[model samples]
Target: MKEFRMAIINLTSSIDRCHNRLDDLDSRLKKIEQRDLEDQPNISGLVATIDHLKSELNVRDQELLANDVEITGISETKEENPHHIVIAVATKLGLTLEDRNIVSVKRVGTTRGYIEGELRPRPRPLVLRLVRRSQRDDLLRAARVRRHLSTVDMGLPGDTTRFYLNERLTYSNRQLFFKTREASARLKWKFSWTRDGKIFVRREHGAASHRIRNEADLQKIFGINEVGAKE
Candidate 1:
C-alpha cells in the first residue's frame, strides 16, 4: 500500500513537470510572435524612407537634364564632330544659335565594329546640352513642328534616313515612361506624352491629362495594390 501511494506521487510530479514545460514553451512562442509583429512597422518605415529618397533623386536628375535633348538616327562616322552636327541640326531647324548657346554635344553609346562587305549602317543617338534652357526649348519646339526630321535636311549623305528628337531623361525616368506608355495602351487611354521632364497620360478623349510623377500615381490610376504595382 505504501509503494502504491509513492507511485501515485511520482506520476503526479511527472505530470506537473510536463505541464510546466508546455506552459513555458507557449510563453516563449508568444514572445517570439510578438517580437516579429513589433518589427514589421520598422521594416515598413525603412522601405518608405528608401522610396522617398529615390523620388528625390529622380527629381534632381530631371533638373540637371532640363537643358538636354536626345537625337536619334544621326549617322556616325569614326571621327565625327558632334558639335558640328549640332550646329547643322540647328541651322536645319532655322534657329540661329551662338557658339555660347551650346554647352556640349556627344554620342551616347559606342560605335559598332566595322565588317567587310557589309552594307548595314549602325548609328548611335546624340545627347546635346545647351548653355541656356531657352535654346533647348526652342530646338525642341522646332523639332516638334515636324513629326520626324530627315537627315538630308541636316545635309547628311543619306536623304533616306529620318530621325526623332526627344527629351533626355534619366534611366529610371526612361523606364517609368516606357511602363506608363504600356499601361496606357493596355487601358486604352487617349493620349500620353512627356513635357518638361514630366510624364502625362490622358484617360479619356478630350479630357484633361494627369501628370504621373511617380509609381504611386500609376498605382492609383491603375487601381492596383502595392505588390501588384511594384516598381
Candidate 2:
C-alpha cells in the first residue's frame, strides 16, 4: 500500500512538471510567432529543459505502465482463489477483472477440488482461431526471434540463439529489431519497434519509447505498418 502511494505521488509530480514545462514552451513559441521580424533569443536552454523534462516524464510514464501491467497480471492470478470469481463479462465485449468485484476470497495453492470434495474452478471456453503461416523465409525469421537474455530453438539440439544489443529478433510473424541506448555510464537498455512504427517499450517486455534514432530508421526497414503491433 505504501509503495502504491509512492508510485502515485511520483507519477503525479512528473505529470505536473511535464505539463508546466510544455505549457511554458508553447506560450513562448506563440509569443515569438506573433512578434514582428525580431530575432528570437537562443531558447537553447529552454529547449534543453524541455528535452530533460520529457525524458523524465517518459520514465515516469513507463514506470506507471509497468506497475499497472503488474497489478493486472497479479489480479488475473487470483483465479486460483477458492472463492467464486464473478465473471460478469458483457456479450460481445471483453472486460478485465478488478479488485472491486472479487468475492469469497480464500487463499489457495494446490488444486482446490479436494477442499470442498466437489468444488471445481469454473471452466473458460476458448474459441480457436487459425492463422496462416508466412511463406517468405525472411518474414518467418523475423517473426520467431525471442528477446530474452538468450534464446534457444528447442527444435534443434545443442543449438542456442544468442543476441546482443543490435541483434534482431522475430515474433508472431513480425520482425522485432533490438537496439540499445546508453542510459548512463554503466547502464544501457534494449528497445523493440512498435507496430505503429513507434518505439514504445515496456520495462517487463517493453520499457518506453525513447523515440530517438529508432523513429528515423524505422520506416526504411519496416515501412509504415510493418513493425507495429499486429491488428
Candidate 3:
C-alpha cells in the first residue's frame, strides 16, 4: 500500500508538471498572436506611406521625361553624332525639323567592345529631347503612322537594321511597363501601351483602360495578389 501510494503521488506530480508546461506554452502563443495583431496596423501604415511616396516619385519622373522620346536600332557610326542622326530620322519620317527645336540627343548605352571574330554589336537606342511637348507628340504620331522606319530609310541601304520610337520613360516606369506587357499577354488582354511615360492596359476592345502606375495598380487590374511582384 505504501509503494502504491508513492506511485500515485509521483503520477499526480507528473500530471501537474505537464499541465504547467502546457499553460506556459499557451501563454507564449497568446502573446505572440497579440503582438502580431498589434503590429498589423503599423505594417499597413508603413506600406501605405511607401506607396504614396512611390506615386509621387513616378509623377516626378514623368514630368522629367515629358519632352523626350527613345529611338532604337540606329547603327552606331564611327563618327557618331546623335544630333545628325536625329535630323536623318526626322527627314526619313518627312517631318521638317530645325536645330533649335532639339534640346539634346544622346545614345543610351556604353560603347561596344571590340571582338575580332564576333559579329558587330548592335547599336544602343537614342534618347532625343525636344524643346516643346508638341514637337515630341507630332514626332511620335508620325512615326506610328509610318511604322517601318529603318536604317535603310535613313541612308544605310546596304544595312537591314530596323528602328522604333517610343516615349522616354524613367527606369522604374520602364520596368513596370515591361512587366505590365508580359502580364497583359499572359492574361490575353487586348492592349498594352505607354503614353507620356505612363502604362495603360485595356482588357478588351471598347473596355475601360486601366493605368498601371505601380505593382498594386497592376495587382488590382489583374485581380491577383502581387502579379509581377519581382519587379
Candidate 4:
C-alpha cells in the first residue's frame, strides 16, 4: 500500500557498521579469553545485545520487502482536456526514430496527438508496474514481485488501461518512458503512461501495436524496436 526506495550506500554502511560491531565484540571476547574465566568481564549482556540487534536487522529486511512496490518515472500531470499528441512515422522507409531524416523532431509547441477528458486519479497497468520495479527496484527484490497487467474497471471496455495518476505534462519535458521486452535488451520500445503509471495503449491492427516491456517480447511480438524495425 505504501512505497519506499533503498539507498545502497546507507544499507551497505549499516552492514559495515554491523561488521564494526562484530569487530568490537571479537576484541572484547579476546580480552575475556586472556583473563581467567572467574575474573573475566561481563560478556553475557554483550552477546545478548548483539543477537538482538541481528534480529532487528532481519525485521528491517522483511519490512523493506513488503513495501517494495514501484512505478517508472512518469512526469505528466493530469489536467482538463488531456489529449495526447500522436506522431506519424513512415514504417516502410527503413527509417528509425534515431535516423533523424525519417521522423520529424517534435517541434517546439507543436501538437501531433491528443487525449481528451478531465483529470482524475486512476490505476496503472500491471505491466508498467513490473517494468518500473525492474528498473528502480534498486534492492533487486522486484524481480520476484509479481504484478497483473490490467486497467481499472470503469465499465468502459474502450479504455483498455487506467492508472493512479492521469495527469499530463507539456510535450517536451519527460514525454517518453522506455520499456524492453527482452530479458536482456536487444531492442528498446518507447511508451507513455498515465500519472498513475498505467501505459496507454489501445490495441491496434498488428500484434506489434501492443506495449512491450522487454526486448525479447518485442522481438517475439513484432521483431523490431523502432517503428521501422517492425515494418
Candidate 5:
C-alpha cells in the first residue's frame, strides 16, 4: 500500500512539472506575439520610408533628363544624321540651335516591323540632349504650338510623317503617364498630360486636375480595381 502511495505521489509530481513547463512555453509564446505586434508599426513605417526613397530617386532621375527632349514618329533612314534633323527642326521652329547647344542626339529603342500596307519599318524615337533646360523647354513649347510639324516641314524628301516632341521622362514615369492616360480615356476624362515628369488628369474642360503618382493613386482617385475594372 505504501509503495502504491509513493507511485501515485511520483505521478502527480511529474504531472505538475509538465504543467509548469507548458505554462512557461505558453508565456514565452505570448511574449513573442506581443513583440511582433509592437514591431508592426515600425515595420510599416520602414516600408513607407523605403517607398519615399524610391520616389525621390525617380524624381532625381527625371531631373537629370530635364535638358532632354524625345521626338517620336520621325521615320528613320539609312546613314541619316540625327543631328541634322535636330537642327532642321529647330530652324523650322524659328529657333537657332547651334551645334554647341546640342549635347548629343541618338535614336532609341528597336525599329518596329512594318505594319500592314505600310512601306517602311516604324522608326524608333530620338533622344535629344541639349546644353540647357531652357532650350529643351523652348523646343517642346514650339512643337506643341506647331502641332502639325512634319518631316516634310523639316525638308525630309521621303513620305511626309507627322512628328511630336515632348519632354524626356524616365522609364517608370513614362509607364505611369501611359497608365494615367489610358485610365482617363476609359473613364471618359477629357484631358491627361505630363509636366516635369508628373502625370495629371482632369475629368473635363474645367474639372479639377488630379495628380497621379502611382497605380494606387489611380485606384483611389478613379475607383479602379486591381485588374483595371471600375469599382
Candidate 6:
C-alpha cells in the first residue's frame, strides 16, 4: 500500500515538472515573436534606404554617359574602321568632325556567327564617346533630323539598312525605357521618348510630358503595377 502511494506521488511530481518546462518554453517563444514584430519596421526601413542608394548610384552612372552616343543597325565588316564611319556619318549630316573631337569609338557586344539559310546576325551597336557634351548633342540632333539615315549613305556596301543614333543610356534606364514603351502602347499613350538619359511620356496630343525616373514613377504616371501595367 505504501509503495502504491509513493508511485502516485512520483507521477504527480513528474507532471508538475513537465508543466513548468512547457510554461518556460511558451514564454520564450512569445518573446521571440515580440522581437520579430518590433524589428519588422526597421527591416522595411533598411530596404527602402538600400533602394534609394541604388537609384542615386544609377543616376550618377547615367551622368557619366552624357557625352556618349549609341548607333545601332550599322552593318559590321572585317577590317572596317569605326572612326572613318563616324566621320562619314558626320559629313553626311553636314557637320565637320575632326579626329581630335572624338574621344573613343568602338563596337559593343560580341559578334555572332553567321547561320546558313538565315539572315546575317544583326550588327552590335557602336558606342561613340565625344570630347564635349555639346558635340554629342549636335550629332544626335542631326541624326534625329535625318531620321532615315542609311548604311548606303555612309558608303557601306550591300542592302541599304536604316540606322539609328541616340544618347547612350545606363542599363537600368534602358530597361525602364523599354517597360515604359510597352506600357505606353498597351495603355494607348500617345508618345514616349528619352532625352538627356531621362524617359518621358505624353498621354495625348498637347498633353503635359511626364518624366519617368523609376518604376514607381511608371506606376504613378501610368497606373502600372510591378507585375504589369493596368488601366
Best by TM-score: 6
Every candidate's lDDT: 0.83, 0.34, 0.85, 0.34, 0.87, 0.89
By TM-score, the better pick of 2 and 4 is 2
What global local distance difference test value does model 3 have?
A: 0.85
lDDT of 5 by residue, 26-117 (tens): 99999999999999999999999999998999999998998999988887888778899889888888789988999999999887888899
Ranking by TM-score: 6, 5, 1, 3, 2, 4
Judge candidate 6 at residue 221 and give its lDDT: 87
Tens-place lDDT per residue, model 3, 1-231, is 999999999999999999999999999999999999999999999999998998898789789889998998777776777787888888888898788999999987788675688477777789999999999998999999998777774654235678998999888888899889888887789899998777899989999998897887888888675475444
lDDT score, candidate 5, position 118: 84
Poorly placed runs, candidate 4 (over 4 Å)? 1-34, 39-41, 68-231
What candidate 2 gets wrong by more than 4 Å, as runs, is: 1-41, 70-231
lDDT of 1 by residue, 1-231 (tens): 999999999999999999999999999999999998999999899999999999999999899999999988877776677887888888878888766888888888666765678465567889999998888999999998966677775656543577878889988889888878878877778788899889999988788888888877888886665314434
Ranking by lDDT: 6, 5, 3, 1, 2, 4
Q: What ranges in model 1 sit over 4 Å off?
A: 1-31, 110-122, 157-159, 225-231
Q: How many clashes show up in model 4?
A: 33
Model 5 has an lDDT value of 0.87
TM-score of each model, in listed order:
0.77, 0.21, 0.77, 0.17, 0.78, 0.83
Q: What is the lDDT of residue 136 in candidate 2?
A: 19
Residue pairs in clash, model 3: none
Q: After TM-score superposition, what is the CA distance of residue 31 in candidate 3 from its true location, in Å?
A: 5.8
Write down the worst ten-residue block by lDDT for model 4. 83-92
lDDT (10s digit) by residue, model 4, range 1-231: 122235766678899999999999999999887775655445766777886786466445433333123322112233311111110111111212123221221212322234357343332211111222232232222222323323333232334442221122222112222333221133333433322222233233342344433234435554444433432
